[model samples]
Target: MECPVCGEHLGDAGQVLEGLDRRYAPCHACSQARLDPRAPPPEAGQPCACGRRPLDQVMAAVHAVLADGGGLAPGAPLAAVGTPLLHPFPPLRSPPFLPPSSLILLTRYATPSLARRLLAEVPEVRGVVADRGIVPGVGGATHDLLAGCDVYAEARFTPAGPLVLYKQVSTCHIEAPRPRDPKVEATDRAVRRVLPDVFVDACAGVGTLGLAAALRLVPAVVLNDAWGPAAWFAGLNLHANREALLAGEVDLLASYADLRDVPAPAAPEPVAAARADQEILVYRGSLWDLPPLLPVAGLRLAALDPFEKDPDRLRRIARRWQDRAGGEVFIP
Candidate 1:
C-alpha cells in the first residue's frame, strides 16, 4: 500500500513481516538468542542485530549511526540514545522482554526522517519513532511514531482467523503483541468458558481487543474510540484483517464531527463503519454515548483498555459499562 498522505509506497512489509515474525524466546531464554530476518543487512537475509548480540556491538553500531549525523556525545550511556520497541505482533512477549529485535527505536535526537535513515545501520531495526512523551493531546500508553510504518499479521493461531494490521505509525497508539495481549487473552478465556454472541471493545485501539473478538468469530462486535485517529485506524485494521474475520462489505454508516462541532451527544456520534452479523461497528466517541448506537445482541462481553491509570476511575469505568450495557466487562 502507499502513504495516504504522500502516496509514497514506503516501508517494506515483506521484510517487516519476516523480521517481525521472528519471535524471541521468553526472557529467560532470550539472553543468548539471535534473530534472523529475511532482508539483507540493509536491503535484502541478514543476521538480525538484536537478541543476544554483544551489548557493546549493538551500542557501538547505534553510536556510529548517531556519530555519522554528529550527535553522539564522547561517551554517552545507552539511555541517552533511546528506547527500542519490538514488533507489536502476536506471540510477542510483553514489556521488559530483553534484547529487542525487529524493533523501532524511539529517540529524541533527530527528526523522524533522519532517525529512520541513520538507524538503518542495524539490520533488525525497522523504523524510528520519536519520543513525543506524555503531554496534552496525545492518547494511550504509547509515545509517538516518527518515520516508517508498522505492520503485523496473525496466522490463524487464536480463536480468530489469520489477520493483517498496519499503521502509518503515528496515527495509532503504541502497542506490542504479547502472548497475552490485552483483551485478546480475556476474549480467549471468555470464549472457552462460554462463547458470547457479541463483543464490545469500548476503548478499541486500532481494533486489537475488539478485533480479537471478531477473530473468535463473534457474531457481532462494536469497536469505538474517542480519538479520531484511533477510530479511523480501527476501521482500517478491520478491513485489513477482514479475511481473518470472515467479514463482508464494510459500510460507513455515520461519522464523527469535530468534538466541539455540536451539543453533547445523548448517544454515540455516529457509526463510522459497519458489517452486520459478524459486524465490526467502528464508532468515534465515548462508550457512554455509544450504547444507544450499538446493534442488538443476546449475549455480550465488553473489553476496555483505558488510557487513564487511576484505580478508582478504572473501577467506575467497568461498573458503568456493566450497568449501561448489561454485559460481561473485562479489562486486561
Candidate 2:
C-alpha cells in the first residue's frame, strides 16, 4: 500500500502496525525520524507532502481490508450499515475514488481486530467506529481515538466560495455520510436570505453556519459554543481561512467565543478591523455571559441550533437575542 503521508511504498519502506482499533504504516523516513536520537519528534497531525495524514493511511488500510473480505461487490447499491444516525467522517463522504456504489459501516463498539477481519471478509464495506456515540454537544471517550491528532480538516464548496473547516472530533458529531445534506443546504439558503451585518451562531459547531455567512461576506460574525473542542477548532478554522478573510473576498469580522463560563452580561473582546472592514476575535466562556460581549444594538441575525428535544433552550436563546438586538433568529 502507498503511504498516504509521503506517498512512499509502504511495502518497501516499513511495516503496517495493527492497533486495537486502527492500523498505521509509517514510511522509513518518518519511522527513522521518530527513532533518531538527534532529530526532533515528528509533529502530530501534520500532513505529509502528499497532503495525507497517518489517519488517512489507516483508513486506506481499512478500505483494503474490506475489499479483500468480499465486502465490496459489483452492482450493489450504496448503503450505510451500523448504528442508526451515526455517519462516517466528512473525508469519507461521497468518496469518488471508491467504487460507484459503496457500503459504509458505522460502529460504536467494534474491536480493531474484528473490524479488520470482518471488513476484509465482508463484501463491499468501509467503516468507522466512534465508540462513544456520535451525539452532538456531548464530549467524552468517543474522541479518544484522536488523542494525539484531534483536528480534522475538510474542504467544502459553497455558492459563495470554497471553504475549509478545522474541527475537533471530540466535541462535535459528524453529520451526514454524504457530501451534502438537504437540511444543511436549506439552512445555508435560509441564512443567505437574511444575511445580517452582524451574525451570531449561538451553537456554532465547528462554525459551519457562521463560516457560510462569513463566506457570504457578513460584516461581523460571532461564533459561540460552550464546548472547548468546538471553540478551539473554530478558531483554527478561522485562521485557516485568514488569507481569504483578509483579502476582503467576503468583508467579514469573524470571532469565536467559548460560552463555557463567566456571568451574564459578559463582555466579549472587541477586534479591530485590519482593513476598514475585516477583523477576527476568539473568546472562551458561557452563553448568558455574551450580552456585554456582543454588539447587541447592531446584531441583525442569529442562528440557534440546540440538541433535539431542547426546544425550550433554543427558544430561550432566541428570546434573548431577539430582546437584545431584535435580529431575525433561525431555529432547527
Candidate 3:
C-alpha cells in the first residue's frame, strides 16, 4: 500500500491499518521530510506518523505534534504540508512550531528541573522561565520574569498603528501584551468609520481599542481605567506613540479614576490653535465620577469595556452617555 500524502510505500495491508489506527499515515521518512526539497529533513513529528490523506489531515497531524510539545525539528519541511491546504492553517503552523526554531517557553511556576528537561528534550528550545503569581484579573495581577531578558517589552500592531509597552513583574495586574481582541477591534473600526469628533475609552486597559480609534479618526480621546497600574501603563503606551497620535490630529487625555470622587479630565480644547495638538492627562480615581468633568452635549463615541465581570456597569455607562445625546456607544 502507498501513503496518499507522500507516496511512500507501505509494506502491507497490516502496516497501513496499523498506521491509520495510530494516526501515523505517512511513513517515518515522509513525516520527517523538510520544507525545502534540497535541504535534509530534520527529525521531528516522528510521533505523529499518521498516514492521512487529502492534505488537511496531514496538517492537523503536524499541529497536534507541536501542541503536544513534541517540537518540530529545525528546518523540517512545513511548506509541503501547509501551502497546499485551501483553508487557513492555524497560527501554530508558522515557524518555531512547524519548522521549530529557538523558542523561549513560559509557564506558571515551572521548576528548574522541569525547565532543564524541556530544554534538553526539545533541541529547538533555547530558554524556559517560570512566571510566578500570575493570576487573571483587572489591575495588578499579571507579570512575568523571563529567564534571561530584562525589561519585558510588549509590541502591539493594531489597525490604528503600532504601540510598544514596558512591563515588569509587579503586584499590579495589567492586560497581557498582545493585539486587541478581534471582536473589539472590529467594533472600534466600525465606530471610527463614522469619523466621530469625540471618543471616550471607558476602562481603557493599556488603551488598545481606544487608542486605535483616537490615533486614526477622532480629534479628541479620553482614556479612562479604574486600575491605576493599568492607567499608568496606558499613559506610557500613549507617550510611546505620541508622534503618530499628533500626526493623526488627535489629542489624548489619559486618566486613572476610581469612579467615586475624583472627576475625569475635561475634553480637549476645540480650538486647535488654543491647545496643544497632543496632550496627555492621567488621573487616579473612579470612572463614575467622570461625567461632570466632560462636556454634557457633544460626545460622539464612547467605548465601555470594563473588567468588573458584571454587565450592569456597562449598561449603566451606555445609558448615561446615550441619554446625554445620540451617539454610538460600543460595549465589549
Candidate 4:
C-alpha cells in the first residue's frame, strides 16, 4: 500500500532483502536522518540541550504533565517514552526525525486527555498514542489503550505478495522488521518445505505468518491469538491482504467480545470468521484452546511463536500438540 501522506511507495518487503529498501521511504521520518549537532542528549530527563525547539523541550513538557506520577519517574530515559516521538517512521535505527509533524507519536506514556493536549500543543505530532498496561503474552495479554488512536500501517513483502498490516504497538508486540526477520523468514521457509494442508499460527500477531502461508497456497489455515487486539488485527490483515491471497470478499465476522471480551489465559469457544474462499478461519484463544477449532482431516503444521523462547518448551509443545491435534509444531 502507498503512504497516506507522502504519496511514495513504502517499497515491497522483497526490496529489503536486496538491500534496496534503505533507499525506499514513504516519508522522511523512515529515511536517513541528519541530527543537528546543536541538539544535545537529555540530561536528568531534561529537554535536549540544543537545537531550535529542541526535542527535549517537547519531552520535558510531556514529562511535566505526568510528573505527579503513574510509573514514569522523573529523569527516566528519553527512550522510556520515545523522546519527542517522531511522525515519520524511521526506516532504520537512526536519529529521531527532527521537527516532525504529519507523524504519530508512539509513546508508552501519557493519558488520553494529556495526549489530546500534546496533539494541540505539538503540531509536529499528528497523533499521540499512549501505551498503558503490559504487552500480550502468557501471563497478561491485554494492553489497555490508555489514549489516542493507532493509525500506523506497515507491509511485509514476500514473493507471494505484499501483506499490509495495521497494529496498535502498545497492545501488540512491536517487531523490528528487517529483510531477515528470523521468525517471518523461518515460517516462510518451513511452510514452503512442509506445504502442509492446514497451517496454524497459534500466536498470530496480526496474521503475519498464517496469512503468509495462505499466500503460499496453503489450502486450509487456522489463525488464533490470546490477546484481544491481536486477534482482531489478524482478522483485519486477512481482509487487507485479500487481493494477494487471491480470496475475493474477505469477510470479517468478529465482535469486540470475540476478541477482547475473554480474560487472560483462557478464551471461550471462539467465534470464527471466514473469507470468500472459506479456507482460512480466525479465532481468539490460547494455543491450547485451538485444536477444537481446526479441520479434522488435513495434515497440519503449526507455529507457536510464543514470547517465551525456551527450547524445552518447544519440545513439550511439539509433543503435546501432536498428541492432541496430530501435527508437527515448530517455534518459529
Candidate 5:
C-alpha cells in the first residue's frame, strides 16, 4: 500500500501499530490520523503520506473530485434517498482536512436546487464530526443555491495526486450530521449579530459566525481561537477576503495564543468591535479565571462552552454576568 503522507509507493504491506486504533495508521512522517478500509474516500489531515497537506492542495483535489462527481459518471443516476454516505468527524485537534466518512452524499430529488438551499441556510450542519465546513464557493462539498424542490448532497474529498472529492446522493431525509455543534455556533453568532458596534470573537472556530456578523453588523471585527489550527484558519479566511476586511468593508481580524499576549491593535474601534459583538465568552479555563465583566461596562453577554458539561461552571459564569446590567449568561 502507498504511504498516505509522503505519497511514497510502498510494498503491498506496512506494519500495523498494535496499541492504536486499528482504524488509524501512523504515516511514515509519523502522524496518527485515521485510515478506514470501509470508508468512502480520503479527507483532510488523514495522514496523507504525500507530505503535502496545504489547504489549497487539499481543496483543489476536493473540487476536482467533486467536479467529476466522485468517480460516478455524469449521467449516472443519483443515489436515491436512504442511500448511506460517509459521515465525517471534525478535525479540530489535527490538521484541517475533510474526512472520507464525514458525510453521506445523496440526491433524492434529482435536482440540485433544494440541496443547495439546505446547505446554505441550515444554521449548524449536524452530525458532522469534522471541525470545519466548506469554503464559500459554488462547487464544494458545501454549496448555496435554491430551487423549487430540495435535494440532499453528501460528499468527501481525499488526497490522490490531487484532492479527490467523492459524493453520494439520497432522496430520503437522512438527518444531516451536525459537523460543529449548532448551540456553540449560535452562542457565538448571537453575540456578533446583536452587538454591532465593535466586537472580538475570542476562541472563534471556523469563524463563520464572527465573520458573518462582522460583515453585517459591526464596522470592525477581530477573531481568535485558542487552537492554533483554528487561528490559522481565520488568517487564511481573512486573507481570502482581505479585500473587504482591509477596505473597512468587513472588520478587524486578529488571533493569538493568549488574550493577554495579543498585541493591542493600533485602532481601538476594531478592539471595541470584537468586545461588543459577543453574546458569549467561550474559554477552556477554570471558572475562577473567568474575567470580571466589570472592566467592560458595555459588555452584555458571556458564555463558557466546554467540551465537558459542568453545572458549577455555568453558575459561576451566570453570577459573573449578573453583577452587570444587560449581561446574560448561557451554558449549552
Candidate 6:
C-alpha cells in the first residue's frame, strides 16, 4: 500500500495502524490521508489512519463474523493475513448454571495473577465478608470489590462454540451456598442479631436474604418477588427448605406482585399461628411505587433495595415505614 500523504510505500496493515477493524490503514508518518484500495468494495469502508477513501475488507470480515457470531474476542490477536481471531470464555458451572472454571480461565487470561491478588487486596471485599457472612472470594458475591476496581475494555473468549465478547470481572463469584450481597448480608446480620423471630425481607432476589432470614426467623418466613426467575428460584429454594418451612413455619410468596398474595397462618397452635399470623411480607416493584407501603398494617421492618439513586424515593419509603410501624427501614 502507498502512504496517502507522501505516496511512499507502506508496510502491512499492522505497520500502518496498531489495530484493525476495517481494511484501510493509516500512514504512521503523516497520519493524514487514509491508504485505501484503488477499487473500493461495494460495502461501506473502514477509515484508515491516514485520511483517504473508505475501506472494504473491514466490513467484509466484520459481517462474516457477525453473521456467524459476534466476532472474534475483542482483544484476540490477528491472523497472519491480519484477520481478527475471536476468543470466548468457557462456562464456569454446569448443566444449567455457569461454572466457576470460566471465571478462573478469564482471570488467568484477561488478567495476571498479580492483578487478581491486587483485587483481593481491596478492603471492601473482605469488609463485606467480615461485617456480613458474604464471602468475598469466588462463589460469594459479585460487586463487593468492584466498587473501585478498574474496568478494562471488554474482552472475548470462546468457552462455548460461539465466540462471545464480555467484560471480565476482577473478582470471581464467591463459592458459598447462601452467598448474599454485602448490603443484604449486613442487613441479615443486623436483623438476625436483633429481631430474629419475625422480620420481613422485601425484594428478595433468589430468596437469598429471605432464605437466610427464614433460617433465623423460623416457622413462618414470607418470601416475595415478582421477577419470574427470582420467583422460580424462591420456589426452588423454599422447596429445598420444605422440612423447615412446613413445620407450620414457612410462608412462600412466589409470585405475589400485589398485597393479595399474603398467606394465612398454617399452624393452629397459638404460638405457631401467632408466628404465622405475624406475617413478614415481601414484594417487588419500582422505587416510585413505594407509596403503597405506607399503610401496610402489622408491618415490623422492611428492606427496600431500589435501583434508583434518588433521595426522594428513599425518604418516601422510609417515611412510609415510619408511618406504618414507626419502624425503621434499611435501604440498600
Tens-place lDDT per residue, model 4, 78-156, is: 4455523232232344333234343455566667776776666654455665554455444655444444444455556
- lDDT at 54 for candidate 3? 23
TM-scores for the candidates:
0.69, 0.56, 0.50, 0.71, 0.32, 0.37
Query: Which TM-score value belongs to model 5?
Result: 0.32
- Candidate 2's C-alpha runs over 4 A off are 1-95, 98-130, 134-136, 139-141, 146-150, 177-192, 247-276, 296-299, 309-313
- Model 6 lDDT tens row, 104-219: 11121112332243234321111111112232222323332212222111111111111111121322222222112465456665665556444555555445555555545443
The prediction achieving the highest lDDT against the true structure is: 4
Best by TM-score: 4
True-vs-predicted CA distance for residue 42, candidate 6, Å: 34
Residue 304's C-alpha lDDT in candidate 1? Answer: 70
lDDT of 2 by residue, 151-210 (tens): 334555555655566543444566543356453465577667875667777677666776
lDDT tens readout by residue for model 3, 146-245: 3322123344456665545433223233334333557457656766566776666766665666667755746656666655545655555555455566
Clashes of each: 6, 20, 25, 8, 64, 37
* Model 4 worst lDDT run, 10 consecutive residues: 43-52
Model 2, position 187: C-alpha lDDT score: 54
Compared with the true structure, all predictions reach lDDT values of 0.58, 0.46, 0.44, 0.60, 0.32, 0.33
How many residue pairs in model 3 have overlapping backbones?
25
Better of 2 and 3 by lDDT: 2
Quote model 3's TM-score: 0.50
Those runs of model 6 whose alpha carbons end farther than 4 Å from true positions after fitting are: 1-70, 73-181, 243-299
What residue pairs are clashing in model 4? 30-89, 30-90, 30-91, 47-56, 48-56, 87-103, 101-124, 136-141
Q: What's the ranking of the predictions by TM-score, best on top?
A: 4, 1, 2, 3, 6, 5
**What lDDT does candidate 2 reach at residue 141?**
27
